[model samples]
Target: MSMFLITCSSSFAQKNELKELEKLVKRNNTTETAALLSTVEKMLPQATDDQKAAYYFFKTKNLINLANSGVDFNENRSKAIESINHLIKFENETKSKKYTTEVTALKNTLLAELVDEAIDSNRNKDYKKSSRLFEQAYNLNATDTVYLYYAASDAVNAKDFDYAESKFKDLIKLKYNGESQTYVATSQTTGKVESFGFDRKARDLAVKSGTHTKAETIFSKSAKPDIYNNLTHILLNKQNYSEAENYALTAYNLDKDNVNSLLNVLFLYYNTNRLDRFEEHAKKGIERFPQNEILLYNLAIINMQNNQNEQAKEYLSKILLLNKNHFDALKSLGNIELQKDADITNKINALPNTTTSNKKRNDLMQEKRLVYTTTLDYYKKAQAINPKDESLNELITQIQDFLKNN
Candidate 1:
């Protein structure tokens, strides 16, 4: 009899608390709603199924109100999600559509609010806050995995490596390639082509209404290679060379047509002292991007290291044709000329002390001076592009003295 009385009192208290919660939620009184929500959650297990349903529904509503009121935003947003999820499950189990629809609508509103705030924060350059908001948005709607991707990117920009690592791994697990098709049409009213951005139905409707023409679908490029490349960059920063190389290779394999991806892998290999792979990727990158200055420059350096000066010169000349003020290429050409002058001087010094040899030595000395003069011209051009280079100033002075003396 005592147990029954205790149950009845608890039930009466739950009813009164729920009524107060409903009134507070309707009034948008976030502070009292938050305090009462805690009281209601504790009484939930003892409440009837219908009472439990009411508790969850009101809980979700009150928490959303708290979130909008800016009182413990992150905590309220998370708790609101939990309440909504429980409400959905309970509605499903009872085979009723009582509160699920309203809860879903409320959740969508929260998701939109979070996403808009996240975009605004990102625009403000508050990357850490943006990342967290995007993550919360993703949690509210797991089907929208793009939010997770954005969260990871913002986390990387914020230098939150641990969060970025976890989110990137989640994306990889989900196989998020980020490829999609866009719809476009030419507007009949304006006589201009318009992009609908994945809204095919809207584009079709525009065409059907005789307000547009040329409805088309355009497939976007896959983003997997870029994702893996970012992961590789993070790992490289952490000095985890083996894992970095693995991810870089994954990026390379996924990037069949992306020159930037190829370049990233080439850099990774080059920095890791894997010269063979670096040369291999550099040549492959050149094949795809023949006019790419960086690829051409990298190949030139490789050839120079291999004692192939003429081939290196050919690459450097190509770079200059593509971009006239290529400072590094010009500087390299100057160094090659200096090397030729050194070789000529060595031969002249080794010549025998005789009349014919004396004449040969004089001729070689003139040739050396001519080569040295060419080097000076190259250095001067390079200096014109980068006048603040200290090394170039010293070399130019030394070359001027050498030309004057011999």
Candidate 2:
């Protein structure tokens, strides 16, 4: 196949050629603008400062216009950024100030456009697309760390765990305290939506104008705690317990009251058999969240693990007081009472051979019967909560049989 190249036939020595490029750029004709810019770049070494400035600026302008027009998606975004850099370089080299305001505003406008699109994509539940868009926006402007946070959050929503982990790690490395402005369109408001960068005067004017109201700055809370907790969750899901625990500890240190992080710490310690650590935080969690049923249940479990049945029973009892239908607590209390039956049976077995002490054996058997009866009552409560549970039903039947035989 033969290829045809369309170059600006008019020489750069002619002003007509520059005007033609400008016309093509304004018309959003990327194909022809790029073709002419390619030819102009070859002449840059000998071109006048003004000619060179015009060339680079219009190149950026053309690409940006194409991006705005949606003629090309990813390609134009990168190309526009690249060309804008070249234009900025030319301005600095020539000590010229032309197009400075336009370049700065357009660059910001491009990033804002990307952010808006990402929000739209996320609103529509296209999390994967939202992640990619926010990622592109962040890459285009790394200073906007909140966009990176949004990208990571979207990746999590998409279940792209590894990618989300990497993005979150980057935020951690930056010590990014995620901050962003939350604009609420109140019933009473003022100012143009695009009018950002509010100072005292601007804010006052905005309020007076009655179309814009700046919501409170979201600076009090750092994004790092959330970031660390998110990392912990991802690590836990991947079964990387050590790393998960480390991240959870970091989050806990950052904010001791972070429930997810604190709970993760408890879970990591408990599941890894670090009962001491589990009990320590579990108690602290209970101190903070007195009415938290899950923490109470877990505390009871930790006590049970250490054979502190009385303490375990106390914790479970509190849960029952708060929520009578707490099935887990009911089941756990039933199981603990069953353990009492086992203890009494052990006592009866250890009694000297019945021939040597029939009376002691009889007393032990009487005590065992009483314990079994209590076990039946506890299990019956559990049965009321879940009658179909096979284990509970079987235990109840065994207790009934023992009572009958005794």
Best candidate, TM-score:
1
lDDT of 1 by residue, 130-244 (tens): 9999998888888888899999999999999888988888999999988889899998888888999878889999899999999889987877887898888788778777878
Highest-lDDT candidate: 1
Question: Worst lDDT window (10 residues) for model 2?
Answer: 1-10
Tell me the tens digit of each residue's lDDT in model 2 across 355-379.
Answer: 8688888877888787778777778
Measured by C-alpha RMSD in angstroms, how accurate is candidate 2?
7.5
TM-score of each: 0.76, 0.65
lDDT of model 2 at residue 304? 91
For each candidate in the order shown, give its overall lDDT on alpha carbons.
Answer: 0.86, 0.80
